[model samples]
Target: MEATPTRHPRRWLILVVLCLSTLVLIIDNMVLTVAVPTIAEDLNASAQDLQWVLESYMLVFAGLLLTAGSLSDKFGRRKMMIIGLSLFGAASLVAMEATSPGMLIAGRALMGVGGALVMPSTLSILITVFDEAERPKAIAAWSAVAMVGLVGGPVLGGALLAQFWWGVVFLINVPIALLAITAAMVLMPESKGPWRKADPVGMVLSVIGMSALVWTINELPKGGLSHHSTQLSLVITVAALIMFGIWETRSKSPMVPLAMFRDKVFTGASFSLVLLTLANGGLMLVLTQYVQFVLGYTPTETGLAFTPLAIATLLFNTLGASLIAKTGTRVMAVLGLLVIASGFVVLANMTTESGWGVLAGAMLLMGAGSGLAMPAAMAAMMGAIPDEHAGVGSALNDTIQQAGAALGVAILGAVLSSTFTRHMPADAPQMARHSIGDALAVSAQTKDSGLLDAARSAFTDAMSATFLVGAASVVGAAVLAAFLMKGKNSGPVPAESAVDPATEAESDAMLTSL
Candidate 1:
């Protein structure tokens, strides 16, 4: 008789520890974005420096994810997590005390390494501790914690920026990391796959390929296809990824089980998530800027403005979790995505005269759609992955979402910048044409309120165009989900789907305590 994996008695407690680990990562990023302008002024940093301050972390984090995930599966998952938490806390201290842009950038890069290690282990460990029957609720709770981070990050950052130095933002992460590490050490059981040969070549290739790919995407909108830097990065990205694919196939034990892609449900879920994240990324990027630059809201007010979206998302998460078993993953995904597209359409029509009411309604729709869609899609995708490869599988999902969001930021940002420039008055000063920030600053110096009006108008026009693109992308994702995903995806992936039957019992026995 086949062994059934025993559910952990303290699984819910473990989930709480996992949420704390995730909270530090999510909240820090959101908080950092809110503190950007203050950091620029305090450090006397140039535009490029600020860009690096953000992108450097993402680049390093994405590059190391697959390797970190694999290592977690090889070493103890809980051990890797504690080490990651310690490193992240130390790095946050370094960043907190940074005296210059270079110092802060270095600190952020180290944190990226820590983040990569911590991130995949959380999901993989969650899957190990929770059985399929309980997986949806566990995931819903985990995801809801992310919503809390999203909501609280800006509010906390706003309060910190108002009272303390910008570095106080990083300070919050220290205690949170310490608490999570302590709890994880006390409560979490270690989990790992059976001993296998390390694929060093695969690790190197994946890092280089993913890093280059992200860099290429980041640069594409800024430099265009013809630029030397973009071309070079593109070449490196293609070559390294192709070589990585070839190496994985021939290797005795591959870093990734590439055969998993053959499953239509997995492929479909991944594709849909990429597009969904793309749309959401664009929306958040543009909306945050609009609420501040165009609407003339304080940073704190802007943070408060997002509360509706978070609330709506939280409520729908519970609703979706409750309904998923009956409706299947495909229905939830399609319905949620369409609602998101509708939200985008609403936001696209927003004019300078439109008050917070319209924007809030659109945010509610976006949140509701996301709450319904994300957990279902993730549940389906994670369900398809085998138990032994859980860590790497989680990393793969993260990579897909990260890449998608990065692409969205680049593409939508470029569109906004270019469209703003075009819509600006021909007589406007060169410095004021590309960015609303620059425009407002120029207007202040020149005492030209007409320039202010022009900038705001141009920005609204640009925002509308950007949101339309987001809507189209989400609509495409909706269609993809409808056609590609199949069957009821609420249950766990079949045991025979990937693993060897001879080792199944042993794997279940080890994983039950995970």
Candidate 2:
């Protein structure tokens, strides 16, 4: 059943609660980066252990997202959300008390489980709460807040690390969760799906497919693509994906409707979103290390440097909503891609002498580019779907984004790492370049001045290469947007459906729109 509009009219209040939850989720997720060294020293963890600490949460979270969304549809959105928030808060408490790497990782996985619940429900709730006329504005507002969470994560994590212990990063979630839980109870109406059967087999196949695929990609730097283990992983991943496709096609209650791909708007929107994320996701890791290791900025200073992206994203993100209404999707998407390409070109030339003005200016342009493209992309994907499939569609969107981010980091990070290792001076002393392998391996050793200088210069070259690559990706996305996008004034899809349609008609129309 669809949610009845609240007579009380507290839409903004509900938005606030959801936004707070998003910020808390993102902050907790990245906070460990600032505290990794401290945690490793205190817990006596190995480098592999540290890797697992990050991967475990993401793996379980991405693996189970579709299942969680299906569960929420079978149950109720409000009910699932409350359960998720409460579980996530409890997981945070467990994380705070973790004395071992394994314990912390387990806690992180639990948090991911809770995160799966919150992710789809939050998007679905907004769709239910807003009327058709106001949805574009609501989604734009929601997307802006979500983007803020992304840009602010590391900055907030840095600030927290400066003042308190590593545990403080996880502890910070407590109050935000409390506020969201309380607000959701008061302001949000309970809603459930036009319910459908849950597909256990499809869920299993999706998890296996995504996990194996990600694992294969992540293994590339450690073991070359030709390694037997790598080849095995690739074979397994491909097999799982093929099985998933087959199962999804046959399943009466598919998690992600296979038919959505038939629509050019859906196909283009989903593909572009993934490609953009692949180019964009690894940027923070590159930029942060460049500032601190190469240029020797303190953590606090590093946090300050990201302010431009934070601020500009907010500004342009708000403007993006308006621009779409006035201009159209095709123009906004194409312009955004061009702007992003320009930003990457500038970033590609970065050096040790680069000042805040140049770096911040580039970042500002990137923020604006992301701000412009994301909402339009989201609109296109959602507009193509019917109301009944909102939960599934939201889950699929988040899944692609999460998986794309992981792959982006793996691919771009591997490239940067390989470039650094190949180019480093052979005469460099052992102590100076002790950790010289890839991005993760060598980032730890960028302490001594000689090594720092080498890494910095190497990173500059590597970053330039990556940015050029990203520019190319953005340009490609622009091409896709130009061809597939309907119009800027037009929502991502045709508008008649988003505004008013019966549930069956909505689903049928989605099938016809392509």
Candidate 3:
């Protein structure tokens, strides 16, 4: 007779802690986006200084994720997470107290380090605590919490800004972090993979490669290959990543198992997610600007307007979780991507005369699709990894998704800027042709209704063009997912790699207890 698998009795409680850990990261970024104007004003920050404050965290976070994840598996996932929470909270305090842009940027970078440590551990720990039967539900709940944070962040930030200073946004994280840390220490069990030799060289190469890749992507919108620094960063990225791949394949004890990509399910899911996030990134980038600048909504109203997306996503996530087993991940993924493409097509038809109704309809469709697609795709990817490689596996997926989103932002930003400029009147001031913001500013200063109307119309046209590109990307993902899922085997992942029997038993017992 086969033995039954062990299930952690307190897995649901542990999941809440994990979700809390993830929520802080989402809320922080969203709130910071809303607070940018205020931050620039109070600090008297130059545009470059503000960009540093925004991008510095992402730069550090993306660069360190794989290393941190590997470290978490080598050490203890729960222990690393607690340390990350403490560091994140402390960094938030530092950022909140900073009087200079430089100080704030430094604090943000430190928070990125904490975020890198925290992110991978949460997913890895979830896989360990919950059996495969319950993993889908756990992931659904986790994804839903992220949607909540997405919807709530802007409204909360807007409210805070109305009553207090911009720094107050960072302060909100402290208490939440403290609660999560306390709960984590009391409730979560320590879990780690079997001991392995360190790969310092791999770590260094990964950090350099990922950071340089992000730098290249961020600069691509400005000058592409024309900028010498961008060209240099691109070269560094390609060289470092190629070397890292070659070294890992040859290493006696590799930091990451490149063989995961050999599984068609994992590879397919990875491609689907990259395309999904890429389009979604452009959606957020362009829609936020359209909502605020074109529709003349305040930040809080903009948050409220997005409720349709959040609500639809939350509902569909629950539905997808319940239905995924019956329909299979492939079907769910392809169907969801198709629905999202439909949403993009709807958005592509939007005109200046179109009201909030068109926007809400598009968001609902996209949200519903997201609710179905993301969990299914992620579940497929994570399902292919052995428990020992859980942390690094998730971190690898995170890195890919991050790069896709960044690339999408760069691509769509360039399209929007260039398209808007091309559509502007020949007689318009040069500054007015740069962006809708500049155009509106000029119109306000000169009292030109013609300029104001022209700017709004031009922005809507540019936004339409961007959404069409987004639509094409999503449609491509759907077709690619269908093709890739054909005739693929998905046998169970292999067991943990040579963990000591006694240690595994002790960890299992601790995890099962309340």
Candidate 4:
């Protein structure tokens, strides 16, 4: 006799735990931005060292996502989540105790590994626990909470730094992780996909390929395209990715199913997500520096400055779920991209003399657009996949965004560096030409007001150029989504692809028995 599936009485509570887990990760990312200047001052880090501090976490996070997803699917989501949280907490302690820049970077890289394990499982588990009808609302709530964390990071970091050492930011994660782990242990259920043989080769190739690609991008500004190391890195990156693609297509038990790319909605959604993240990643990093070094805002004041952006995101996220049901994913995504582009346009006109009011308006527009667009894009990508592939599907979604973010930081950082160098005064010190931080340091030491004015002007010009690039990319994505996602609306998963209630129930019985 077929057993009836047991419904989870505490599903909503489980979601709270999951969202808390996700929030810690999100907050960690943003907090680092606010803390970077202080870290550089304390650690005596150079421009390159600071870049690595930011990039190392993203590199490992993006590289390991697919393998982590496959592992979570093969073992169990709840088990993996616990393991991930434990590792993350341990890594946070390591970061807190780090005595040097390299040590901190290593700790952050370790945190990335834990993050890769946790991220996909959260979404996959959500998909499993909630039925199709409730999924969109659940996703919206998740996105909204994530935005809250994003906004809160600067504020939290500022507050912590005001009263404590820079390491306090890392320490904050330890307690949050402990709470998440404890709640998850009591409330979350273990679940896995159908058992399959492992694909170890695909995992190695993906990690190597992605790492090489990110490295090459990071080196491009320093070495240019023709440099020997950059050339070699590029070759390895291309070859490894090509091999990974071929292997996945031939493997009987592929870690990531390549067939999903055939769906226009999936492809469009993924592309949109990549572009959106790429634009935002670079823009946010640049803006943080601008607010602090250029506008002379203290860390606490900088955090307060982002309040408008957070409010805008919160307002729109609540409306996005219903908006998608009415206008469809295609229309919503395109419109959101357009709005984001408009925000970039507003920012492109900013000068060093621009007031906070001008910057706040840009943040508001960008936040509203992202809130409306991101959840809808995520829903389209998630909906197109079968429940059986949820772990890998969620991983793919995350992988693209991380890769885009890393690349965005690399490429856009390069743009800012080169532009600043070109516009800098010919007689500027070598240290001053390296970065805005360095420039400010040199100016302070030499008491060179002219050099300071030149640095500010050069950075403002570079900032404008970067915003234009972001705007162009977003506009291009808007056009592509329009063409590819035409006539498509966010809808329930097709019946054939959805999990059977009977099968789910039987699986629940088996798990309960175990």
TM-score of 1: 0.92
Q: What total of clashing residue pairs does each candidate reach?
A: 0, 5, 0, 1
Q: What lDDT would candidate 2 get against the real structure?
A: 0.75
Sort by TM-score, best first: what order? 3, 1, 2, 4
Model 1 pairs in collision = none
Q: Write the per-residue lDDT of candidate 2 for residues 1-514, one digit (tens) a residue.
A: 6764443388778877777777777777766777888889988999999988887778777877777777777787777778888989999999899999899989988998888888888887777776544555667778777767766667787777777888988888888888899999988988777768778888888888877777776787676787999899889889988998998898887877889887877777788878788888767767777777667788767867877777776777778766664445555666777787788889888886898889999989988887777777777677676667777677888888887777778777777776666666787654333233343234455555566567677777777777777778777877777667552223532243332235324433432342
Candidate 1 stretches with Cα past 4 Å from truth are 1-5, 488-514
Better of 2 and 4 by lDDT: 4
RMSD (CA, angstroms), candidate 1? 6.4
Off by over 4 Å in 2: 1-8, 226-229, 429-452, 487-514
Runs of candidate 4 with Cα error greater than 4 angstroms are 1-9, 33-53, 99-106, 425-434, 486-489, 492-514
TM-score of 2: 0.89
TM-score per candidate, in order?
0.92, 0.89, 0.94, 0.88
Tell me the TM-score of model 4: 0.88
Single out the weakest 10-residue window by summed lDDT for candidate 1. 505-514
In candidate 4, position 133 carries an lDDT of 50
Which of candidates 1 and 4 reaches a greater lDDT? 1
Model 3 lDDT tens row, 1-514: 6777878878899999999999998899999988999899999999999999999999999999999888988998998899899999999999999899999999999999999999999999988898766677788889889888988899888888899998998998899899999999888999999999989999999999999998888999877799999989999999999999999999987888898888888888888888888888788888888988889998899999999999999999999876665555666777788889999999989988889998999999999998988877777788788889888987887888898899889888888899999999999999999999999999999999999999999999999999889989888887666656432322111233222445334433432341
